[model samples]
Target: MVSVVGFLFATQARMPDHLRFAFRILTLVFDAWPYATTGKPFHRLDLPRRIDQVERWKRSRLAFRQGLIAFYRSFVIFGLYSELSKQDADRGMRAKQD
Candidate 1:
């Protein structure tokens, strides 16, 4: 998640201030919304609960809500694959060194 955020902000550095501000607000709402039902922040939730929350957002009736999750999901998936490939390259380099 941290990596995703880092990648998002780093890649979005040139985005308009208003759009970036909106993204930050939406992120806070995403993390804070779960607190109403679970009495815990989104980050503090267990894996199952976290998945459930994301699923809820993905299935939300609001178009913006659904879009928010979609945006986040894309970054997350991309970040995961990128990290995996990086690790693979590092491992291959180490193997060659040995």
Candidate 2:
């Protein structure tokens, strides 16, 4: 969320008010997609935890944390992209063997 906000703030000074508002709305939709399902407002909801709540709750704190980590992991230097590049290189090398 901070990253998205930082991006918005960095561009705000030069961007017109209307465009900035649109940018803000778009960024919010990306960030809120996971929690905004089931047609409910999730920001104020208290999530449940434990076995009984697994299938019944909106989202537990653990899931929120994990999802956030996964989101950042995709773009981090040594995360998804790096791993994907390594896999691609290995596959190319193996293909040469045949």
lDDT of 2 by residue, 46-92 (tens): 56422222332224455544443343333343444556787899999
Candidate 1: worst 10 consecutive residues by lDDT?
Answer: 1-10
Assess each prediction's global lDDT (C-alpha) against the native. Answer: 0.85, 0.49
Q: Model 2: residues >4 Å from true position, as ranges?
A: 1-8, 36-98
Quote each prediction's TM-score.
0.77, 0.28
Name the candidate that leads on lDDT: 1
lDDT score for residue 70 of model 1:
87
Candidate 2 Cα lDDT to native: 0.49
Measured on C-alpha atoms, candidate 1 has an lDDT of 0.85
